[model samples]
Target: MKNKSIQIQEKHHKELQKLSESLGQSYGGLVEKMILYFKRTGIDPDDLKNESPTYKIQQLDKRLVSFLKVQERAILKPLRQETYEYYENHNKTLKEAKSLINKKIVQADQNSKIRTNNILKEIDKQREALNSICEHLDPANKKGLKTVFQNIFKNAN
Candidate 1:
């Protein structure tokens, strides 16, 4: 390594020496690392030291961007996934409920039709039985039965 000396204030030199010792590095290495860090990050040490508004705004912007990215990853992504899953499950449940209701309605319609047909058949049998009874009755008995039926109906009304 080429050894060279650069003039600096005594206080600055002493501070640099202390930093180098604490970090267990040579003065040249420490200074080179500091320069590289500043260059890589596109930071101006003078801007930081001067506390410029523009520099403060830039730092704030970086922090805000970082916070947004973290929120997106840690909160937004999972919440969105859970919501989508719930939406899908709710839709599926609705479909199942609709299908079940439709099946039940169809079954009820079929049962009602069967019951109606059976009731019609029973009415027809009762009409036939009444006609046979009328045919078997003598003229006098028929007259008496008709009078009794009329009186019963009149009382009901």
Candidate 2:
């Protein structure tokens, strides 16, 4: 093995010595173990990978996204329910309006039919009065203007 020398601050060396004592290792042995750990993990011993705020922020971002998804579902559930209820109420109202319109249409048809029947009855009474006048004018024969008037009245009826 080759010997190498590296200089460190006095305070850092003292801290290293304290760590070495706590670990029940010589300072040089502790340094060797740290170097071995770096070689095995392919990481620098001084790098605060897990303890850095950047890593904690990334974890917090993931948890925040999950929490937002839960909140989104919780908020949308009531909105969806209200939307469904609104449409259902509108549909029922539309159905009621349609039925009312249909009833009005039926009533109008019945009224038109009644009016038509009344007009027909009036026409029949007018024809009968004309026929009675024709009978008065030609009581003896069944021919001439009385026959023509009877034919016209039959066709009209």
TM-score of each: 0.50, 0.57
Candidate 2 lDDT by residue in tens digits, 1-157: 8767779999999999899989999877899998897788676656766354577789899999999888878987778999999999999999999999999999999999999999999988988887788789888646675788778977866
lDDT value for model 1: 0.84
Question: Residue-wise lDDT of candidate 1 within 32-134, one digit each (tens)?
Answer: 8988978887777877365655888999999999999999999999999999999999999999999999999999999999999998888668756665575
What's the number of clashes in each of the models? 0, 0
Name the candidate that leads on TM-score. Answer: 2
Model 1: runs farther than 4 Å from truth?
1-60, 138-157
